[model samples]
Each structure stands twice: as C-alpha cells, then as structure tokens.
Target: MAIKVLVVDDSALIRNLLGEIINSEADLQLVGAAPDAFVAKQMVKQFQPDVITLDIEMPKVDGLRFLEVLMSARPTPVLMISTLTEAGADATIRSLELGAIDFIPKPKLGVAQGIEEYRSVILEKIRTAARSRVKTQRTKVKATSHLSYSSTEKIIAIGASTGGTEAIKSVMEAMPPNAPATVITQHMPPGYTSTFAKRLNNCSKMKVVEARGGERLLPGNAYLAPGDRHMRIVRSGADYRLELHDSERVSGHRPSVDFMFQSLVKSAGSNVVAALLTGMGKDGAQGLLALKQSGAFTLCQNEESCVVYGMPRAAVQLGAADKVLPLEAIPEAMIQQLEKVKAGSRL
Candidate 1:
C-alpha cells in the first residue's frame, strides 16, 4: 500500500507542488491538501493520513499550537516545513519538542529548483516519518544516579538525527555540572547548529557550544558539530581539542556520527562512552562498531524509546552497542560505563 500523505500549508503553490511531488512517487499517495487548520482538521479526520507535511507559519493557529493539540489528541507522525532563518530554526526545534517526527527546510534560492534538489531527501524523510513513533511529551525526567566523573581522561560522545534535538536535551540536562567533556554530532543543516547549541546550553547543567575547531575539550562542557561540517577529536599535549573538517560527506552526512565515532576510535576510544540515539538512517552504525571494537563503551537507544529507530537500530543489529537502553536510562548508563572504563574493567 502506498504511504498516505497530507499537505498542510496556507500557500496554494506549496500545496500543489508538494502534492505533485507525492503523486510523482508511486509509493506515496496524496490523501489531502489543506489550506488552513480548519480545513486541515476535517481532512485529517476524513483521510487519517500516515504522514503530514506541516508549515510553521500557518494562518490563525500556527503549526506549533496545532502540533501540540494534535500530539495530545491524535498523536500522528508529522514533518514540519521550515525555513533556514534564525526564527525558522527556533520554530523548527520547538516543533520537534512538541512531538513532530522531523522537519524539512524550505529552499533558500529558486523555490522550484531548490525543493527539487531536495526531492530525494524529502521523500526519504517522509518515508522515515511514516515509520516513526510519535512520542508523547512527558514531564522532564532527570537522571537519578549520582554522577562523579571529574577526570579529563574520560570523554562522552553522542550521535543522533531526526528526533535528536529533544533526545539530546533530555540527556544533556540530566548530566551533572562537573560531568566529563562531551562531543555530539546531530544531523542538521548549516546555520542551525548554533541555535541548537545555545538552546541545549540553556537547559543543560554543562555548557554547550558549537564546535569551531581547536577548542579545548574541558570537563562540564559539550561541543556540538557545526552543521554540514565534520568534527573530530585530536590529542594536543595533555588535552583534547575539537577540530572541524570540510571533507566530503561520510555516511551520507557531513557531520556524520560515523565520522566522529571513528575519529575517537583512533585517539580516545577506550576512554569514551558513546551513545547512538534516534535517527532515520545507518549513518553511525559502522563507526559505532569500530568504537566498540576499540574498547569504547557504546550504547544504542532502545527501539521503544526511539522516535525513528534507524541509527540505533543499525548499531544494535551490528552488535555495536554494549547495552541497548531507553532514552531516559541512557544518562545513568553512561555514568556507569565511565566507572567501568575508569576501573579498566570491561566486566
């Protein structure tokens, strides 16, 4: 059966173009094109689409409000249509927190050509969304275990995509203020990572900032891979520094989890505790396996806790994860992993 999709945008042009795109694919079916929330509500009831493409700046009720209500009521997988501007990025992240499956940015240049260029990505995101779990917004759950990792010898690495922003927030905020240095690569477009880092910093006990290469990896601080750029860890004297690379995309993403994971395997794998979280592809699977083989403690978010169980699922399949855990349990697991590594015992 074709995956049913609904286009919900105020713009007639967008609705038509997106409709055409869906119809062009034999595996996708256009269930409805709604111009506003009122019409969208009726269409949603009438068609019960498997996936929905939502615009943030919809008339009257805005996408976020609609999403909150929808998630609370119907809880369906939704892909937000967002722009690349600061405001757009903020709204896009907010939508993800409200239980949206993922987002696709609007073209920056020629609308038709730009969107056409992203045709494959858009289709892939839609297909992934269709298979995604629409997670409910639960009260923030903080880690209950005591965290005491204060050594510069320990490193924590994380890789995520799709539903990662919220997942990252959950774990980061639960970390202790003096936690080990952390590195992250969350699949995102250029110009969005800065905003994301700032958001994470605000809620997290540790400082979080966008990686700009050559920054010392300090305890209680987290470095986020700059969007579209690869991040690597390098040892300088007695300390580690985060470095950025302009190399070609690895595992289909520039800031690939695999790229970051493999770099740690070469330098500090034994001292690292890496976790692969919710995403829509196998970008981090091989790299995670390498980390595990290099003696790093690796973790994969369990399928039930994942919004899109692609990356972590791949890691689990490859036997890359030392433990498969739920999203909420990962922080405690990381701390435990660090203790085991510190004691130099895999047991």
Candidate 2:
C-alpha cells in the first residue's frame, strides 16, 4: 500500500501544489489536505495518514504548538514545510525539536516547478517518516555497573542512524549549555545535516554546529559530522581539532561512528567518551569497544528510550559500553563523566 500523506497549509495554492507532488509518486498518496492545524488534527483520524506535511505558519495555533500537541498525543510522523527565510530556518529547527521527522523549504508559487525541487526530498522523507517509531516520552534507566571516569579534557565521539533524528535530540537536550566539545556522526544526506545542525543549535543549550575541516574542538561546542565525509578528531599538542576525511566507507557508512571512535582511541588514547545512540545497524559497536579497551568512558542508549535499539545493542554485545542508560540520563551521565575528567580524577 502507498504511504498515506496529509498536506496542511493555510494557503490553498500550497496545499494543491503539495498534493500534486505527492500524487505524482507511485509510492506516496495524498490522503487529505487541511488549511490549518485544527483541520489537520481531524483529518489525521479521518485519513489515517502515515505522514503529515505541516506548515509552520498558520492562522490559529501555528505549526510549532500544533506539532508539540500532536507528538504528545497522537505521535504521528510529521514533515515541516517552511519558508527559506531566516524566520523559517528558526521555526524549522523548533519543529524538529517537537518531533518533526524532516522538512522542506517553502516554494515560490510564481516560478514554474519551483515546488518541484522539493518533490524528491519530500517523497524520501515521507517514506523514512512512515518507518520511524519514536515514542512520546523518552525513558532513562540506570545502568547495572558503574563506569569509571576522571576531570580531563577527553575527546568524546558519538554516532547514530535511523531514528537518530529524535534520539540525538534527546541526548543534546539533556546536556548543559557549557558541555564538552563533542563530535558526532549521524547518517543523513547532504544539505540535511547542515539544517539538522542548525536545528540542534537552536534547541540545545550546547553549541551544536556542522563540522568543517580543521576547526578546533572547543569546550561546550558539539560538531556534527558532515554527510559525505568522515569526521575524526586530531590531537594538536594540548588542544584538539577536527579532520574531515573521505576515507573508505566503514560498515557501509561514510560518517561511520566506529570510524570516529576508533580514530579517537588511537589519537587521544583512553581520554574519550564514546557513545552509541539509537540506530538500525552496528556501525559504532566495534569502535566503541576500541575506546573501551583503551580505557575511554563508553556509553550506549538502552532499549526503553530508543526508537530502535540496534546500534547500541550491538555496542553492548561487543562489551563497548561501560554503562547503558536510558535516553534522558545519558546527558547527565556525560556531564558527570566530563567533570570527573576536569577534576583530574583517575578513570
């Protein structure tokens, strides 16, 4: 069966255009259209849509408020339709925090096929969204054993995939504004990661930004690995820096979590916090183990709060995770671990 989609926008022109794009794809079907969030809520039950395309601006409640309520109540996958302007970017990022799966910039109705640029991405997002299964409230369970750590500027490396959109969000949201300079690898397409980084920057207190070559890893700044390249941390005497490499895809992933974690072990030795989040594969398992062998603080997401427990499960099986906690506690645990390092305590 085709993936059922509902397009919600105040403008009838935008609704019709989106309907056209979705209907053109054989795998996607436009089940319904709504002029605002209120109408969209009713249509959701009426149409039983697998995915919803939501506009951020509307007459009544607006998109962000609606998205929050929807995720808290119905928990359906939603794709944001936003303007390309600065305001749109801000709102788009906010929507993602509220559990929106992905987004497309607003189209210019004047130009021919202006809306078509988003057709491919929209369909792709819908397909991916339909497959996702993020829950309303994240769970955070404590680990059975205590993981050792100390107060030093250890290099932290993380990785995620599949339901990582919300998985990463929970982790970052729980972190302090002045957290460690962290690096992350998430499986996402080009242009998307940039937007994802921007979204994270807005929602999280930490400085979350897209990775660039040779940028210094500063305190409290979290760099996201670019889509096409692998991000590795290079030690420069006392300070740390980022290296964007086009190395062979490890475990079929360019920004492979294992690749970054393993490289950190070789460069920073045991001075690292290696984490594996919710994903569909075992990409980070072996690398996290490497970090553990080298004495790095290792963590993984437990099944309760994960959208899919595959990646973290693999890491646990490999004995990579020193502690496996629920989603809400990971950030707090990270902060504690980093404080231990800063205090110069023994691991």
TM agreement with the true structure for every prediction: 0.96, 0.70
lDDT tens digits, residue span 133-158, model 1: 88877436566455544777888999
* Candidate 1 backbone collisions, by pair: none
Error of 1 at 251 (Å): 0.6
Local distance difference test scores for all models: 0.89, 0.78
RMSD in Å for model 1: 2.6
Model 2 whole-model lDDT (C-alpha atoms)? 0.78
lDDT of 2 by residue, 1-347 (tens): 99999999998888998899889888888999999888888998798888899989999889999999888778898878887665776677667656776677776466327777767666766786787665665443332122233222666677898667677876776666555577889986555678889877886767999998898776567899987799888887776788999989998788888889878987886778777888766898999888889889999988877666778989898888899987777777776777666634322
Instruction: Name the runs in model 1 displaced over 4 angstroms.
Output: 138-140, 144-146, 343-347
TM-score of 2: 0.70
